[model samples]
Target: MIKFFRKIRQNLLSEGKTAKYFKYAMGEIILVVIGILIALQINNWNEEKKYQKQLHIKVHSILGDIREDALQIKALLKDLEKQHSAADHIIPIMESEQKAIVDSLKFILDFNSFTTTPILSQQNNTWDYLSANGILSELEDQELVNLLMNYYNYFDELTINFNNSANPVRLELRELKYELFTNTEHRKFFPTKKPSVPSKAVYESIFNDIRILPLCRYIGSTAAYFEGRFKDVDQKAEKIIYYLETNYQPI
Candidate 1:
């Protein structure tokens, strides 16, 4: 094509047709400009396609991370509720006449420790990477970003606080309960399938103990807070999942 154009220009110039040569040169210039414009347009399209592909990969990774977190948190949430149930049993028995029952004390011995807590698994790497590198915005889902922030920042911190607070308090409760009961009674309560009756005075001592009640209150409130936060996280995860399943796709 270049040679063809060159020959035509040479013939026109050699014939001294300067006007036609100028017109042909101008036509050639226009064609070159059009070609450049087309090249630039194609480059821009390729860049956009690459951007979309990257966003799709990041979004898919994030969805997978959240789904795992959701599964783990579901079990953790149930565990928190179970702890609450344990607290529920202990508190009522202590507050009521049933405190003297051997079964009640056995239940207390089984469930009174705050050592058991929900173990939450977080899928933070995906979120942290996308966020720190500033790729999270590539997906253009501001709502999803905010929800993730809430989970990682606020909700994760809530879980940490709940666990940290329980640790020292659990030790204190264990010490106090041992102090309130005889070694024989405490040991007997544990291995006994059917808890045998301890003296009413033993029950009264535990019930009237100032230390025990505070520990109970702490356990109850903490369990309640944990349960609520678990539910809140569940809802947040579900919403993101819904958005992903409903609206999610390769960009």
Candidate 2:
């Protein structure tokens, strides 16, 4: 093509039709500029297609991560519900005159509930990768980006609250166990060890302690709060997943 254009230009110059040559030269320059622009536009289109393909892959990965996060949140919610149930049972039993008559094994199990702390384990590896590489900005759907940000931010807040507030209450309850319960009673907390049934006196001591009831209430409240937050996060993840699956198609 270059050789063809060069031959045309040489012929125009040799003919010495000066005005016609200038016009022809200008037309050739215009055609070359048009061709360069067309090539550049094609290149831009290819680059855009490549970027969208990569973005779709990343979005698919994010959807998987969110689905896994939802599962983790579901499991954590179940554990929290158990803890809450334990608290409810222990509180009523302690308040009742039949506290001593309550099954020793059941009472010990409920008492041991405070020792278990449910922590949120978020599946955010892909999110972190996108953020670190500044690829989040490349996402065209700002709404989806916002949803993702909110979902991950909720996890951050949950972690902060657990560490700063809920965890301390749980730790205090655990320490109280050491001060209030005998070694035999403590061993009941572990299911593998078949400890002797705790004495009525042990139940009496636990029930009579001023610290136990309030601490149990605190633990119960924390569990309930975490359960609610986990549910919200699960719902948000579902929404984001649905949006990505429905709207995004790779080039």
Top candidate when judged by lDDT against the true structure: 2
Model 1 spans with C-alpha error above 4 angstroms? 95-98, 102-106, 109-113, 171-211
| Sliding window of 10 residues with minimal summed lDDT for model 1 | 109-118
| TM-score of each candidate structure, all chains considered together | 0.77, 0.84
lDDT of 1 by residue, 96-193 (tens): 76454557554655454454545556787878887889876676778877877877786678768866885567667767767877878766554467
Clashes of each: 0, 0
Give the true-structure RMSD of model 1: 4.1
> What overall lDDT, based on C-alpha atoms, would model 2 receive against the true structure?
0.80
Consecutive 10-residue window with the lowest summed lDDT within model 2: 188-197
Per-residue lDDT of model 2, residues 1-251, tens digit only: 88997787788788877788788889988998999999999999999998889888888888888888878778777878888888877777777776644567776777777777666666788899999999999988899999989988887787677778887888888787788877766665565565556676677778889988888888888888877877887788889988888887543
